[model samples]
Target: MDLTYSAQDDAFRGEVRDWLEDSLSGDFAGLRGRGGPGREHEAYEERLAWDRHLAASGWTCLGWPPEHGGRGLGLLQQVIFHEEYAKADAPARVNHLGEELLGPTLIAFGTQEQRDRFLPRIVAVEELWCQGYSEPGAGSDLASVSTRARLEDDTWVIDGQKVWTSLAHLSDWCFVLARTEPGSTRHAGLSYLLVPMDQDGVEVRPIEQLTGTSEFNEVFFDGARTEASLVVGEPGDGWKVAMATLGFERGVSTIGQQIGFARELDAVVELARRNGAIEDPAIQDRVTRAHMGLEVMRLNALRTLAGSGTGSQGPEASIAKLLWGSWHRGLGELAMEVAGGPSLTAQGPPYDLDPFQRLFLFSRADTLYGGSNEIQRTIISERVLGLPREQKA
Candidate 1:
């Protein structure tokens, strides 16, 4: 398999690198490292403004077809853009759910009207989005989604709870997975509906994390309503559409995430040097392993993207999830180790965690969110290895 970038691709990479360098240098320099994974609350409005600046510059949604308000960039160029953005330490994006997840899903499965209604807003960052997938008992077991919606004339009324919904409190829209056909069970009778978040019946309560931050929330949709036409695909087709959205989640954007991961690793390594933790053989060994593992992850993700293109990743996406999740959690622990005794104490009595401390705490969920490692393993085993499905009790 070819891993080399074409000369044209390399030139595109240079263009991306130059653009990011120019974009993040002056007025946006303060946002260089803010509003990332665990710190979405940092300078949030500023980040929102920065995201609009990106939209204005036409830097968003590079992989979508040009007819859909995108640049229609190829796979390698998209990868290059993400890589350069991370290298430039660009501000954390404020619209990943809308841009990365939903936009591509619509391009593939959504009706023309759905595209016309949503794609431009998503491209322009006019509406922020959150995934309404995980529920109280159905975090990774999507077929167990208990949220229910029923059509009422021109609207669909929804009622249910969604837990661990990222950015639900801040989102202007939610794409919900609900049971539309009453008695059907296990992946049937479900629908993917796009619901607005500002109505009177919707409630979002922030879920505080171990890092003392709340990037996700518990949302209660009590008699919430949306137009009946908002369902992404036909009824009973949520499983297919939702799976595709999740597949899109594992796309080239992760290269930017890995670049951030590399920065964290570098910090840990520098601490090891200054604090003399590098002298410890075990610490040295773990550090080496972490660096090597990240390289492996980069290569594997490139291979997966090359074959799958944009929105249609297969079982290999599960492998990508499992690899990065475990590796990140391990890096968090290693950060604490390298920080030595100082990692335990916060800056204030109430608590102000240093970056490493926050990383250690926040990365704890790396294996849990966006499909748990256990779920990824199950997908790989059942779909790739020809294994039988595990029976439910």
Candidate 2:
């Protein structure tokens, strides 16, 4: 995989850096580092405004085609934008679920009518989305979903529960996976449906986490109705479309994620030195190993993107998932170890946690969400290595 940046690409990077600096340094300065995992409630309204500002400045969807309201940039240019954005410490985006996942899926797989109906809203951040693949019974094994939907008159009626749905409470719509055929088992007869979230039939209850935040949620769809035409692909082709969306979930932004990881690692290293934890050889060894892991994560992501197409990150994307998820969790542990005894206590009463404490707590789920480490290993073994599938009970 080539890592060289051309003169034009370097100029593009400069433009992105300058715009982010100017934007974040001015009226939006308060949002420089607000709003992320474990802290999604921090200045949320302002962060939403920051997202709109990004959309207006034409900086939100860099790699999508110009016809679809994106810059149509090359892969490396996209990488440069992400690196610069992370370096600038911009606020976490509010519509990433729409911009990164659904936008690309519609562009690649949706009908022209579907693209016309959804792409504009996604581009302008007028709507936010959440994935409904994981049901109460099916979290990592997504194909085992039991949510049911059926066509009635002119609408599709849905009924089921989706747990661990991030941003559901704030989302305007949800893309759901449901059993469209009666008594359908496992993967067959499932449909990818775009269901609106504001109807009386829908309910969203927040799930509080160890970090004392409720960014994740449980959504109940009791006869939730969406337009019959809202199905993404063919009725039974949901698995293909869903898998592609998951691929996009592990897209080029992972490079920026690693950048954030590096920053956090640097902070932990400083904490160790200040607290004298670095005087101990074991703490020193863990910190050094974290630095090395970050480098390897970056190289592996670049290699994976080299073989991937525009929207699909490919089956080997599991390897990237396994790598970063475990590495970030490990970094959290190292942070706690560096902090020594104080990491065990909260900064304030009622579960008020300092950033380091929050990191240690929230990173606990990094390996479990999106796809669990065990599930990722299974995908790598069966899909990438062509190993025989494990026998199920």
Candidate 3:
């Protein structure tokens, strides 16, 4: 595959970069400068405003059809746009679940009414969305999800729980997967539904992480009701729909995140230099390794996109996830080592202090989220390598 961009692609990149620079003005600057994980409510609102601004400019959904408020750009242009957006230090948009996952899935499988109802709200950041896939018992083994949504008259009555739901507390809706058939086998009995969070019988409780923040939540559905029209695709075809969302989540979402990771890597290098650790041979080696790891990830992502076209993720998506988890873990460790005792204490200036300390703690979850590294290995071995399936418990 040719790594070099065509002349037209290069021009498109310049246009995107210029647009980002102009769009990220006063408040955007302040929000982007806030380096740590936590952001104030005002900051989040400002970020949403920026998202809306991008949507209005037709840059938000770069790869979507023109009718859907996008530029109808290709996959490479979309990737370039993300890369430039990160470089501009723009505030990260909070509508990722909607823009990155749900919107695309809806386009592929949802009815025209469903698309018209959700896609516009998603683009405007007027509605926030969360994924309801993982449960108390079912996580990496997603087919084992037992959240039941039984048809009751014209509505589906949902009852079960979803754990580790990111931003669910602040979300307006949840794209959920639940078992619609009692006797049918796993993976064949499920259905996907989009349920409003404000409705009766729906409860959301925040899950406080070690970082002292409630970014994720445990959601309960106690006979919650959703119209049958909210269902995506036919009943018993949910596994396929869920996989499509997961593939987009694991593949394209990683592209955006890796751009952020590249920025973080640069911050690490700068931190090392300021701490007088740049001269250390070991530190230099770690920095080089981190850069190399990110390059490999970039190439892998490009290869996957080029080979599949239309950003359809394949088994290699799992490999990218695995590499990302490992690379992030190593980078975090190296950052902590370079920072020494001061890294543990979080009292200094946010930018001057060790950013990696928080990153290191967060990296612990990287290997586990969106299916664990062990599960990725299983996918590679069984699906990619054509190995025999392992015995189940």
Candidate 4:
């Protein structure tokens, strides 16, 4: 409940703010506001270089332990860093899957060899990683994943399709969930394997969105191979490890996402005023609700991090997802309303959209991806509220 920052916290925030303001200039100046949610395709090569720059400055994995090549920042300090980074309008990061998801999972569940092999690369931004959990049939219902992998000759051969994989085309490695035990169903008999994406058997086809951008991709793993030792936890324990990774998905970096959301809200408000849409009472009410929702989200996320401490998430994580997803989607509606008829048409050329247009289009998927709102409600009901699971037919 202590929302106030200590003097040390204030100093840390100032340090973060100063570093970002200074470093995001010169050669990195163009990256100030590039590579955000719907704009990941912007200046990607430059952003990769920016990631390495962050790694070199020891800013890649601020929440990780010191032994793992991180700043070992506390929860409050981590929040401050993310807030400052977003406030500075620093470029959206490229190595988040590796730094935020895989690094922590490796530290927590990976073997010594796995940690030694992968943790340093993650810290140094030497290799990028992607999540391979969702499949053609198992986007949110992970228990039904159809991807299968078999162990043979000290390697696991994987065969399946993973859809909507973010950055799969650019990633060096993928932490995949596949069925290892034949005839197993639901959450059982699955293995979490770290497979390389460069092999010939792997194929990545970018999935173009309504925004005419392809930040997501369809990855085909046809006999994709990885060392048997690459599995994070024991075989057939992917349910546990994968769920743990889902928990990590809602870690401290979410504060940075909220800051970004705040920026988006500001943009929408500015658009309303510019277009004179603010005169509409309904538009004004929606704008007010969006602002209030952002505050509530930040508070809820802070409370979650306080109790959960950057580790695996509790049921509260579902609430966070639901809240932010709906809020962003609503903002998209508001943006469209503010833009009026102008929002319906592309700015120019072969399917190009301005920022507000892109936001409106991309936000449509907000409620669908990363555990859909419906699935989040199910989690909240069964896990958080202790409701009985609906009987399956």
Per-residue C-alpha lDDT of model 3 across residues 1-393, encoded as one tens digit per residue = 777899999998889888777766665667664422433233666676777777777666667787876667888888887777777777767888898889889988999999899888887778999999999889888888989999988999999999999889889999999999998767999999999999889999997665556677899999999998999999989999998887777644467678888888888888888989998998999899889999899888888888878776877788888998888878778878887788778755543223576677767787888889999999999988999998898
Candidate 4: C-alpha RMSD to true structure equals 0.9
Query: Taking the tens digit of each residue's C-alpha lDDT, what string does model 2 give over 1-393?
Result: 778888999999999999998899767999987888899999988888888988898988888999988989878888899899899989988898998899999888899999999898888889999989897779999989999999998999999999999999999999998999998788888999999999999999999999989999999999999999999999988998899899898998888888888888989999988989999999888888888989999998988887774635988999999999999999899989889899988877878898888888999999999989999999999999999998999
lDDT of each: 0.91, 0.90, 0.82, 0.90
- The parts of candidate 2 lying over 4 Å away from their true place are none
TM-score of predicted model 3?
0.94
Comparing 1 with 3 on lDDT, the higher-scoring candidate is 1
Clashes of each: 0, 0, 0, 0
Ranking by TM-score: 2, 4, 1, 3
Model 2, C-alpha of 148: deviation from truth (Å): 0.3
Residue lDDT tens for model 4, 1-393:
688999999898888888898898999998989987789889999999999998898888888899988888888988888889999999989999998888888888999999889999999889999889888889988899999999998999999999999999889999999999999999899999999999999999999888778889999989989998999899999999888888888988899899999998999899888889999999999999999999999999998889886644777899999999999999988898899998988888888788888888898999999999999999999999999997777
Candidate 3 pairs with clashing backbones: none
Give every collision pair in model 4.
none
The segments of candidate 4 whose C-alpha lies over 4 angstroms from its true place after superposition are: none
Compare candidates 3 and 4 on TM-score and give the better one: 4
Each candidate structure's TM-score, on Cα atoms with residue i matched to residue i, is 0.98, 0.99, 0.94, 0.98
